[model samples]
Target: MTRRTSKLDRRLVAETALRLLNEVGLEGLTLRAIAHELDVKAPALYWHFKDKQALLDEMATEMMRRMAADTAAPPSDDWRDTFRTRMHGLRAHLLRYRDGAKVYSGTTFTDTSYADGMEENLRVLVVAGFTPRAAARAWLTAYSFTIGYVIEEQAMGPDPFAGTEGYDVEARAQRLAAYPLSAEAGREMFQDHERGFDEGIGAIIAGVEATLLRRGA
Candidate 1:
């Protein structure tokens, strides 16, 4: 006879899986690994999640749930600042785990909890004078940019210039001689991705605001 799992067992399995994900990353995460981490057999994990994908989905949702909680209670006024702070918080949370963005981007949430967060974001945008449709579009665009940026940022790894660390200006110039404009931008371009991210995010917000204003006009 199979043993029934308690709520505690399910929570342990999920928490254990999260820890394993942090240690081994998405590629290395498996039911067997999670079970071993919990000092239980693989079947014990199946009692909670049917397979690796199911576990991954649960983990991804849990991450979003945390994000919703962390960013849920924003301060009143200054919607722009509120949105920016939320994005920053989301980025910080994703950075906490290995390949976190990869896992988050793979899953979708239509649950009430996530929907409430989305509704709140839209409400903020609408209160800032955006039409409902524009508010929705802006939220979706900002979300897409945030997710895409985080995935690329994480994939680029801790040291983006890992292979090009020793390459001097002249060496870089020679390497990019074929693409003069891109080459002329300098090694600083390769060194400061965070600045690029900030600039891009700023531009997105500005563009959305401009669209809203133009629509009103």
Candidate 2:
């Protein structure tokens, strides 16, 4: 038998880990699995990543890198439009992989590669008359909403598109048969998440303007 030799670095390790994530998900993902995918020993990964958390951080950074690269259109100047576009894009990005939101959540970015885009976002809000603090709050609010929404969205199962058979709306309605509205709500909640996300984010951005920006103005 011949020994397999491969060059290892943070990028390769992280990228490999990300590809495996769609198959194994966050729970099943392990350092050994990543090593196995790379055809290297588990110990070899440690030279690049101190632990699984470090590896996760890199995976998240790579996800963000891909998202940034994929976004070709120029960002809108209006703060609300900018946020709406970003949040929608984020949901789509996270939905691309199983448990993508989980991978992103709570992982400290391995580097400042995300800073420039972030800076531009904040600048847009500030230019639109948001005080710096208010801009941060508004961005955070929209961000939290997007992340949380995608977490639930991904939880619906493997099918990212609307009308995924994995989630049984009729069964849910039957389960809630005693309560008609609650029963009907299954279709709304489960059938089309895209619609819910759009409405929810619009309300959030509008609420921010009405409450925070207006009061400040």
- Across 80-167, the per-residue lDDT of candidate 1 in tens digits comes to 7767776777777887787788888867552455777777878887877888888878777777787787776666556222322423
TM-score of each: 0.80, 0.92
- The regions of model 2 sitting more than 4 angstroms off are 1-6, 158-164
Clashing pairs in 2: none
Candidate 1 global TM-score? 0.80
After TM-score superposition, the amount by which residue 112's alpha carbon in candidate 1 deviates from its true location, in angstroms, is 3.1
The residue-by-residue lDDT of candidate 2 on 29-142, one tens digit each, is 999988788878899888988888999899999999999888754367778888899889989998887789999998999788788888888888888888889889999999
Give every collision pair in model 1: none
